[model samples]
Target: MATAGPTPFDPAAEFDRQVRTLTELGYPKLSGLAPERFAALLEPLRATALTAVAGEAAGEYDPESGRVPFVLVVTRELAPIEETMSRTTLHGGKLPGFVDRSFEPGALERFVATPEARHPGRHAYLILEVERGEEFCGSVPLDAMATIAGRGRSLLTIEEGVALITHFPQVLVKNKCFSLGGSRSGDRRVPAIWISQKAPKLGWCWEGNPHTWLGMASAGDRRATAGSSGS
Candidate 1:
């Protein structure tokens, strides 16, 4: 055969690859923690996210293999993504670069940062997936949401932000884009989580917020979209 052309990127595979690196890196304290409690806390987040995603559409959230990957749109070019997942910070998991480390040696009964989170620093990538509505976002400023909407987009919550930080610390927010007329306004922005490379060990915070870019159009812009329903 002749020379092969380039191929498109596989989001799922690429996501898994990124996650694999962390797993390989290893969470020093993962083995020591109570698997039951850790699994229990994680389950609720997964359930709620899955339910919210499923309520909107099928295949939005995947639980088959526990990949739990989300789309991360980069509003800006190569926004810094996190690489480490730390426990709670001084302000309750609201600090940069995994500052207030909390391995919680015996606090398994309560909750402490995993050893994996104690890592010094990591690289990150800012990714984005099209979101549905304003169900996940509770911390985002209400006024900001309205202003952004006027620019041809809407604001959603960063549900995955916590999980992303807790696990990968690479992604920022689990945001969404409005399907109404397929927003294509160049000025529109959507916050997203970034994959990391050599960034600091930024534990978790609301600063990594990303914005959507080039508009959120599926087929065309400013046009009504229709779908068929079951009989």
Candidate 2:
């Protein structure tokens, strides 16, 4: 069977979808901001050039290749991380999302951005050049991190990973999930997302471990944006 191609890039449509999803999910309440204010907060990023680039198999993507693109990350400031995961769904929105019990309270908060991973530092922004790193499947995350950095690409954080799935849940297919090695708690645990019992799960794996089915997720770069801007 032939594989399907990457989803077409459409910053305008995606921005609208995200705004709608966030509003319907009651994001304004989560951010402690009025609906109008919340919408205003996202206005600036309307101009972000969410250009899509060619993706290579697991280990083949070039860190230097042209701009990589995907997803708008509403940082922890605007939307709580765990709550975002809980509100996410998969399988045509039928199955609800959940975090692993092994993640203690504040556990997700413990993970921070690695040097390789950069963001715009805004309440809400875009993550560009997103790649699932399927080529690194069966490779240890620590090894994958070194390789990704060596290539000048940044690893995807737990937030970025969640954002990817939130907008494109279809990416979490069986035997091809991804690890968020960029978000480290200063130990062995590597946050990841995968399909579980027909549902989506936010969990973790060992940095030094290798799973034939899991690859580390990464992106080309991140940009900070503000005010309402668009194509």
Candidate 3:
């Protein structure tokens, strides 16, 4: 018997492959929260405005079990407001505007700095866990993973993390979205990839290509046998 050589990595091609796989797996419809709904979810941070963004359909197939997981692209924008009663109450003093003029860019960082900020604004992805006969799990932010892990809170399993990236590849790709400085000339867009169980224990890592090597982690060895759908 002869072993096959590793396949060459091509970011663009891998992205197209994942998107195509998602579509074929039956993730045809994409939905997102309206601006009002987004705002409601971000109500705690009244100074922050949430704008739901457009998303694409995605799906992944498990070759081992012949199962397919599907998902939708969902995004939200946060704009910092200068004043809010909530901020005044939390900080014990009226602080400056939530939006920092000196920062120039990186809205997500600004969101995390505020005393009441629950999440990082830029390049941050939130995952909502769904389990049968259970209330919807609270939103989990990707940037806060280390903190959560440090605190020894087993709030999320590796499988959940994998599911998150599978459903929202945009989160990984959009990390550097603002690096272009508003210049649209000859800019290159990163491709997205979906990590299946056959790929690695890192759940699913995608950024342009499956081999691009942006980051990796052990999501653990948790498996879903059947009737699992990305909702």
Off by over 4 Å in 3: 1-3, 30-231
| Tens-digit per-residue lDDT, 104-210, candidate 1 | 23221222212211111121222233333323233233344444456543222222233333443322322332111211122222323222333223222232242
Residue 114's lDDT in candidate 2: 72
Ranked by lDDT, top first = 2, 1, 3
Better of 2 and 3 by TM-score: 2
Q: Give the total clashing residue pairs for model 1.
A: 35
* Per-candidate RMSD, Å: 15.5, 5.6, 20.6
State the lDDT of candidate 3 residue by residue for 64-89, as single tens digits: 12111222121223222221101211
Candidate 1 lDDT for residue 35: 38
Candidate 2 per-residue lDDT over residues 1-231, each given as its tens digit: 554444454566667887877788788899999999998888766665333322321223222221235567888877878788887787366777889888998898888877566466658777766888888889988899889888887888888888888766767777778899878888889999988868889999988889998987887767655332211
| Model 1 poorest ten-residue lDDT run | 217-226
**Candidate number with the higher TM-score (1 or 2):** 2
The candidate that wins on lDDT is 2
Q: Tell me, by TM-score, which candidate is best.
A: 2
187, model 3: CA deviation in Å? 45
